[model samples]
Target: MKLYDFPLSGHAHRAHLFLSLIDVDFELVAVDLASGEHKKPPFLALNPFGQVPVLEDDGFIVPDSIAIMVYVAKKYGKTDWLPEDPQQAAQIQRWLSVAAGQIAYGPCAARLVTVFGADFNANEVIARAHSILTLIDAELANRDWLVTNRATIADIALYSYIVQAPEGNVDISFYHDVAKWLRQIEALPGFVPFPTSKAGLRAIS
Candidate 1:
């Protein structure tokens, strides 16, 4: 298995984190977003969307971060991380949508501005980050995990960007439940950290 990754990308990091958490042996292929490598023909063939975190396992190809996690969980028979129960599965999928939608526009976009110098309006995205985070904080108040009693892909899906939200100028300190949840994920066996950036350090400091 190989994962096309960008070190600074939360999208890629989420996929990377899941692969590690599942104790899989996979090679990491770094994509040079700085040089437009993902946009080039070679990488575009893997994912026309020109994104990192594309997974290639033997002859099969999987694109998108959450998709990669699903593929990996199903492939490895990790039912704990992705339950098969109808209601539980639906709940997990819902949070995945939140990850792709709310998390994307919120925390992810905010961090993009600081970490990669993306052109998003920082204030707007940061505010958006807080909105979703506030909801997530409320949801987490009565539960240890999002969709079920145990850790699932939903938690993995939401972990990356929210953990680093402070870097986006979206302070997470006030969200006590969210902060505790981050620590829980971090403490998981085989957990791999999303690499912190100097920009993130400066922002939080």
Candidate 2:
């Protein structure tokens, strides 16, 4: 299996973390997002949308972070990553949706605007981001992980951006529950840190 990804991308990091947690042996193909390599011809052939974290297993290509997580968990990981019960699966899906929707809009989008200098209404986005964070903080006030008693793809999907919220100038100090949750995720076995600098990003690239 081959994973084409940009290290700094949280979405890509989710897949990488999942593979590591499952002890899957695969090739890491760095996509140079800094040079617009993801949009270039050869890379676009892998994913028409030109996104990172494209998983190629035996010539089968899977795009999107959620899809990759599901594939890996179902194919390689323990059943805990993806439960069998319909209610349990729906609970996991709820958090995954939160990661894709509110979390993306808040921490992820804010980070891109601040770090990559992307043109976006920071004030408006930050407002939305804080609302999401506050909601998450409250939800996590009495829980450790997102949806399950233990770690799951739902936690992995949301951890990257939420943990790095400080880098985007979104203060996480008030969210003590989130801070604690971040620590818990980090303590998980096979945990990998998200890229924090241009050099680290280049190394992953």
lDDT winner: 1
Q: For model 2, give the 10-residue run with minimal summed lDDT.
A: 196-205
Q: How many residue pairs clash in all the candidates, one count each?
A: 0, 0
Cα shift from native, residue 47, model 2 (Å):
0.2
- Candidate 1 per-residue lDDT, tens place, 105-203, comes to 999998888887889998899889999999999999998889888789999999999998877878888999998889999999999998877675454
Model 1, C-alpha of 26: deviation from truth (Å) = 0.8
Model 1 pairs whose backbones collide: none
Instruction: Kindly report which residue stretches of model 1 are placed more than 4 angstroms away from their true locations once superposed.
Output: none
Query: What is the C-alpha local distance difference test score of candidate 1?
Result: 0.92
Off by over 4 Å in 2: 198-205
